[model samples]
Target: MTTRVRDDTWVWALAGLALGLFGLGFVVRWQCTRGACALGRHEWLFDLDAVGSLPRLFTTSLFLAATVVAVRVAARSAGRRRLWWAAIAVVGVGLVFAKLVSAHSVVEGLDGRGLTLLVGTVATVVGLPVLARLGRAWGVPGARAVVLSLAVYAVAALGLDQVTGLAAGLDPSPLPDAAATFVEELGEALAALGVLAVVVRRLPHPAER
Candidate 1:
């Protein structure tokens, strides 16, 4: 019971932290958009679209941490369980690189919508079933929650973002560009943090192992 409580505490704490960080970015963005705050030289720190912004860094760090935890878990696992964690770790690493390099721009540069659709379709058709089988074999706690979080992240960051861009090109978008960017970036960061929390919860303490 105590261990369960502790695990729940960690999950809630990480969720709060993710929201708090997003709130801070939103406030800064609102102030800057209103010409109320003098961003001066540190504007990048508050700009959600910037590559090395605070939000981006936090998100990248979360992915890296998740990867580390997955690697550790894999090291102690065997057979299909090890493969499951190893696959998750690889995905985490890809996410970290994607965040750091702003991979969306590259995707957009190359037939954006088409590429996204193709990749999303392939992932849904191929990746989901494979991962589902591995997940059932491993029986990792909180796997469903983590997958749901990733789904939300993909919708906000990939789907909505492209739609927003297309709308902006066609006419004056109902959703303000800044607001859309803020939501996309915040969704991604929160999702990454969620994945990290679940992975951490499943990783046993050194003493336990």
Candidate 2:
């Protein structure tokens, strides 16, 4: 990772995107909530009609563009194999659906939770095999590091709510909900970058091994 950061331009791009999301999403969140209560994004957007769609549309566009670039790179080297093509369709649809969800917005009630869980489960099922292959394309050390970074990202993005809910049920302490929210947003950016990194890391393909 260290050497790749210096040698590869994509690494720099990924790093920049990660930092940009952290600065934009995380910093605003901290300012609004002061690292205290969770500010539900859909609720906030529900009231503030003017400023909500701008950021989500903008960020989603950027992420989709990055995904296209990664897919292009992979296709160039590996060709459009089954996993490659299927992964693209799955992730592309997922991102589009995510964007639609953001634009339409959903109240985080029981219905919303069920919807979100369903979407998340489907995405996880489709994405895991592709992501696993990408991680292992790197050798053991690089693969391990990439997978770990992605794990941090996954936990922060996907499982944080469940973990926090359990914690709250067990002990109603002041959960840094604000902080967790920012981490979740930041993790999305980082996770996307991690996928890009795996693609353009200049490592040998699995077949080469």
Q: Itemize residue pairs with steric clashes in candidate 1.
A: none
RMSD of 2: 7.4
Every model's TM-score? 0.79, 0.53
Query: Tens digits of per-residue lDDT for model 1 on 1-209?
Result: 23644436766676677677767777777677666668776867967767888878878888899899989988877677777878888888888898899886677678866786677657655865577666876785556665655566666566666765765576543336566666777777776777787777677666654
- Taking the tens digit of each residue's C-alpha lDDT, what string does model 2 give over 1-209? 22323456766775675566455554454445444425555434412112344334444554465456545544544333434433543555565566546522353354644465566656566656556676466323244443444354444545654544455456543335444544555455556555545534534445542
The TM-score between candidate 1 and the true structure equals: 0.79
Which residue ranges in model 1 land beyond 4 Å of their true spot? Answer: 1-4, 10-13, 27-37, 137-149, 166-175, 205-209
Provide the global lDDT of candidate 1 against the true structure.
0.72
The lDDT of each candidate is 0.72, 0.48
